[model samples]
Target: MIAHNNMKSSPRLENEHEHENEPNNLIMKKLLSRCWEESRLLWRLAFPALLTELFQFSIGFVTTGFVGHLGEVELAAVSVVENILDSSAYGVLFGLGSALDTLSGQAVGAGRLERLGTYTQQSWIICSATAVALTPAFVFATPILKSFLHQPPHVSRVAGPYARWAIPRLFAHAMNIPLLMFFQAQSRVWAVTAISGAVLAAHVALTYLAVRRLGCGLRGAAVVGDISHWLIAAAQFAYMRGGCFPEAWKGFTVRSFSNLGAFVKLSLGSAVMIWLVVSIGYGSLEFWYYTTLLVLVGLLKHAKLQIDIMSVCLNYEFMTIMVALGFSTAAGIRVSNELGANRPKETKLAVVVAVSTSAFMGAIFMAFALIWRTSLPKFFSDSPKVIDGASRLGYLLAVTIFMSSIWPVLSGVAVGAGWQVPVAFINVGCYYLVGIPLGILFGFRLKHGALGIWMGMLTGTFLQMAILLAIIFRTKWEKQAELAKMRISEWGGKNENQPLIS
Candidate 1:
C-alpha cells in the first residue's frame, strides 16, 4: 500500500510541473507578439513627424536652391553660416526640448498631471535664459565667423547680412521648441506637425517676398526665416492658451532659479553632448572646405560645384535624421511611461520595438539614397560634376543614415529610462575622442576630403550606438523604476520612502 501511494504522488508532481511550463511558454509567445505590435505602434506615432521633417527639408532645399542661383560665393556663404548657426542654436534648443519628453512621459505614466505642466513651464524658463545668454554670440557674429573660417572678404560681406538677419531666429526657436515639446510629451504630435507645416509655408511665402518682391536678396530670406519662427511660436502659444492644453498650461509660474538649476543639471549633459558632436562635425567639414578644397579648386571647376551640391544632399540627410529622432522621441515617451507605471515587461517591449523599427526605417532610407543618387542633385542644380560628386558621397551617406537611425531611437529609449548621464558620456567618448580626431586626421591631415570626414563620423556613431545597445540589453527596468522613484521624490520634495509610481 505504501509503494502504491508513492507511485501515485510522483505522477501528480510531474503533471503539476507540465502545467507550470505551459503557462510560461504562453507568456513568452505573448511577449514576442507584443514586441512586434509595439513596433507598429511606434511607426504610427513617428510617421507624421517624419512627414513634417521632410517638409522642413523641402523648405531648406528651396532656400538653398534660391541662394545658389545668386552665385557660388553666395551659396558657400549661406552654407557655412547656416551650418554654424544651426549647430549652435538649433541643436541646443532641440536638446533642451528633449527633456520634456523625458520628464513629462514619466509624469503622465505616474498619473501626475500637474507635474507635466510644471515640467513644461520649467523648460521654457531654462531655455529662454539660455537663448538670452546666446544672444551675445550673434552680436559678435563676424568676429566669431572669421575666427573659425578664412572667410574671404566677399564671403564675409555676404555672410555678415545672413548671420545678422538669422541670429534672432535662435531666440524664437527657444520659445517654439518648449511649446512643441509639451505637445509631443502629451502625444499631441499632430499639433506640432501642423505648426511646423504652417511655419514652413509662411517661410516659403516670406522667402519669395523677401528675395523677389522686396529685393532684400539673401538678407530678406534671412529676415523672413527669423520672423516666421516668431509667428510659429505665437500660434503655438495661442493654441495652448486657447484651451487645447489647459491642464498643461494651468498654474504656470515662472520657474524659480533653483528649479532652473535643477533642469540644467538634468539637461546640460545631453546639451553639451549634442553641441560638441554637431560643432565638431560641422567645424571639421568647414575646415576641410576652406583649408583643402576651396583654395585648390576654383568655383568654375566640377569639384567646387560638387561641394555646393553636397549642401543639398546634407539637407536630405537632416530630414532622414529627424525622422529617426521622431521615432526615438516616441520610444522614449512610451518607455518612460511604462517604467513609471512599473511595467517592466512593457518597457522592454517598447525598447525592442523602437530598435527594430528604426533598423527597418534605416534600410528603407538606404535604398532610396542609392536609387536616387544620380537624379537627386539635378533637383537642386544643373551641374553634372556636382551631381557625380554628390552621388559618390550619397552611397556613403546612405550607410550613415541607416546607422544614425538606430542612434536616436536607442538614445531616446535610454533618455526615457533616465539614462542620460551614461548616454551623454558615451557620446563624448565616441564623438569627441574617436569621431572628431579620426575625421580631422582623414579630412585634413590625410587629405581624403569630405568623404573621409564622413567616414570618421560614421565610425564614431556606430560605436556610440553599440554602447547604447549593450546598455539597453543589460538594463533591469524594475531597478530603473526604483531609481526613478527616488529621483521623483527628490524633485517633488517628498519623503525618501514615498512611492511616486503608486
Candidate 2:
C-alpha cells in the first residue's frame, strides 16, 4: 500500500496517477474500494446534517402548519413572511459563516486545530455584522411586500407584523452558523444533531401551545421560532466554549482579528456563494412564481382550485431542500478534507462519489414522487379538489426534486474548492440570466405557468450542474491541495516549524 502520509511530494502524486492505468480489474477493485471508503465518510457527515437541516426546516414548517390551521389567510401570511426571511437575510449571513467551513475543513485536514477556532471567531464577527446590515430588510419586509408586491389586503396586513415578530431569528441564525461550521469541520455534527433534536422537540411544543392553546396566532408562532434559533445558538456557544474540542477552541484569541484582509475577502466570496445558491431559484423566481400562484389563488378566492397544487409544491420543496442540504454538506467536507491532506487524486475521487450518490438519491426521489403522486398530497390537505389538483402537478414536482437532488452538491464542490467568488458569477448567469428569464418567457409569454417556471428552474439547475461538473472534472487537483497547504501554513501562526495544534 502506498503510504499516503509520507507520499507528499510531486513525484509521489505523479506516480499515484500513473497507476490509474493498471489492468482493468485492478482499477475497478481500487475504484470500488475507494467508493466504499468515501461512502462511509460522506454518510457519517451527511445523515446528521440531514437531520439537523430537517429540524431547522421544520421550525418554519411547524409554524406554517399551526398557522395553516387558523385559516388560509394566516397560512399565506406566514408563508410569505417565512419566504421573505429565507430568500434574503438568512442566505447572505449563512453564506458568510460558511466561509469558516473552507478554512476549518482544510485546517482539520492539515492538522491545524487551533486555526479552527480562529476561523470560527472571524466568521462570527462577519456574520453578525452582515446580519445587522440585513435587519432593516426584515424590519421592512411587509411594507416591501405591500408596496412592491402589491399583495392582497389579508396577506399584506398580517405578513408585516409576522415578519416583525420573527425578526430575532435573523440574529440567532447569524450566531448559530459559525458554531455549526466550526463543528462540522471536525466531523462533530452529532453535536448539532442532538441539539437540533432537543430544539425541534421544544419548538413543536412551543408552536402547539403558543398557537393552539395560548391563541397567539401568527405572533406566537413567530416568537417561538425566534426563541428556538436563539436557544440553539446559546447552547452551542456554551458547549463549544466550555470544553468541546479543546484543541480547536483554544479559548479564543486576538489573532483572529489580526489578518482582516484575507479573512474578509474569503468571507465575502463565501457570502456571495451562499447568497447566490440559497436565493438563486429556491429564493428567487422559483419562489416568485410560487408566491404568485398562492396570491392568485387567495385573491381569486379559488382556494379549492389551487390548495392541492400548493400542497404539492410545499412537499416537493421540503424533500428537495433537505436532500440538497445533506449532499452539499457531504461534498464540501469530503473535498475539503482530501484537499487539505494533499491527496489530489482522492479529492477528485471524493467529488465523483458525492455527486454520483446525490444523483442516485435524486433519481430515487423522482421515482417515489411519481409512484406516490396521488397519495402524497393527503398529508398536507384532505380536500378532494386539493388532492386532485396536486395529482396533476405531481410529475412536475418529481422533475423538480430531481434537480434539487443534484445541484446543491455541485454548489458544495465550489465551496470546498474555494471558488465561491467565480461560482457566484456562474450562479447569477445560470439562475438569473438564463433560468429566471426563461421561466418568465415560458410561464407567462408562452403560457406554461408553474410548470414553465419549473422548467426554467430545471434548465438553470441543469446548466449549473453541468458547469460545476465541468469545473470539477477539469480542475488541477494537485495544485488545489498545494494551495490548501500553503493557506494552512500562512494561517497557523508565526513559526513555520512549529507543530500544528492538533
The digit string of per-residue lDDT tens for model 1 on 1-502 reads 9999999899899999999899999999997788678877777677766665555545656677777666776776676566555545666666666666677877777766666666777777767777887776666666655555444446556667687777777777777777766776677767767877888887888788778778778887777777776777887787877787666667555543446656655665436564343322321322232222232222222444544655656666766877887887788778887887888878888888888888999999999988987777666566666667778888887887788678878877876887655566577777767876777677667877676666766677788788889989999888988876666655553342222222
User: What TM-score does candidate 2 get on C-alpha atoms?
Assistant: 0.85
lDDT at residue 147 of model 1 (Cα atoms): 56
lDDT per residue, candidate 2, 1-502, as tens digits?
3566656676877877777666776979988998899899889889898888888777877777677667656766776676545545666675666567777888788787867777787777777777788777668877776677655565667778888887788888778888888888888888888888899999999989998999988888888999998989998898898786888888767766765556875554435555445323222333443444444333233442443356446645665767677778878888888898999999998898888888898888889999988997665455566578778888878887887788778878877777766776676687668877787777667766656666766687678778978988899999999988887776564463343322
Please name the candidate that would achieve the greatest TM-score relative to the true structure: 2
Q: Whose lDDT is greatest here?
A: 2
Q: List residue ranges in candidate 1 displaced over 4 A.
A: 1-29, 53-58, 151-153, 212-214, 254-258, 268-307, 493-502
Error of 2 at 280 (Å): 11
Which sections of candidate 2 miss by over 4 Å? 1-24, 269-315, 381-387, 493-502
Each prediction's RMSD over C-alphas, in Å, is 6.0, 8.6
